[model samples]
Target: MSYSVHVLHNGYSYLKDGVMRANCTCTLIKGPNLVIVDTMTAWDKDVLLEGLAKENTSCADVKYAVGTHGHSDHLGNLNLFTAATHIVGYSVSYKDEFFIHPFETGEPYKIDDSLQVIPTPGHTTEDVSVVVKTAHQGTVVVAGDLFEREEDISDPSLWRYIAGSENPDKQQKYRNEVILLADHIVPGHGPMFKVTEDMKDVARRDQLTQK
Candidate 1:
């Protein structure tokens, strides 16, 4: 069976022969098993399963179906992977309780003992980011909504919304968690950032300055 991956760019998807653009960033990582990061809007179970089957991996082997948060965009197609175990941080596990879904803790479930999950809420109550250490990719962070590359990354309104939301104190905690990451930053909706030592220094400096 052929193993491959597909990184569906959130924006600029319409440039391909004038097709419609979808929601959140969708990533299908297929190896011995299958793992989907986020399921964008307008995408359903059949479409995702069909696309994944192209790589010779069926939805049945989807050992892990996870979301960075409870947002509609991220968890839109979660029902498609019902057979697979769901992974989400403890803070937002209640959201899936109604569905009678059994979800494991993101931090404890490691992929090859190299990838880790850092719970960084504030964008929402259950937002989390995935950190990976691959032989080829080195250290990388899959920051879902918690961080972005667009100008909105530091927009005052967004920050205010996060800081003044239902969990205001958690905002600082989330920022602190991000500051601890000295690895490459990959956002859910923008270009990835090479996390160099210099960039980490800048990010830490900015965090301290904000404090």
Candidate 2:
């Protein structure tokens, strides 16, 4: 399967749907710098490089390669961009032998002045989502494993894996943020969708009902 590169509203180019069920990487290009959101498997590294090179983006130009969490699939093949800076959440360091090298660092991506970290840790202790107001995308959430369009965020079954496992408190926090700040939901898996203004009220009502 051939992957198609699409430019997102945030002035980033993303790869969607090649193989392995749309595990994608989104790139933010500005001047000579690129910020790669996620890296796929080791086998797909060359393909990712080729695709980025075609768009005039490269690991050499990468300012940061962000792994949403410490999952092997998310950060394992990060060797492709040895030149790029690797960043992840504080909690990710707990994953055993997961750190191939000391190159990977940890930091939180700030949202607003008031809303800095959208700590959605149930997916993993390190699982955190980012909320940023982009010029074209308005308010959007790059919600790695925290939220997925493939399943309803409100689904109780979603809690089976993470509930009482680690940082279970974040499950409700994740749901609450989706209803408030998200104009668009950009998943690390599956398609991206906009949460309509009308839906905001419904989402809020859903939150209240769930409570």
lDDT of 2 by residue, 1-211 (tens): 1112232222121234742233444434333234565565555666566667777776677665666676655564566666765656543222232343321233444423422334566567766565555556556666666654424454544343422225445555565666578767666554666777665776687677767
lDDT of 1 by residue, 1-211 (tens): 3333355444212224655333566666655546677766545556566667765666667766668776666777876776676665433222245332222332434555555556667667767676665455556666666654433344634444422334545655565456466355555556665555654565577667667
Worst 10 residues of 2 by lDDT: 2-11
RMSD of each: 6.2, 8.2
lDDT of 2: 0.52
Top candidate by TM-score: 1
Off by over 4 Å in 1: 1-6, 11-22, 31-33, 42-56, 89-112, 153-176, 179-182, 196-198
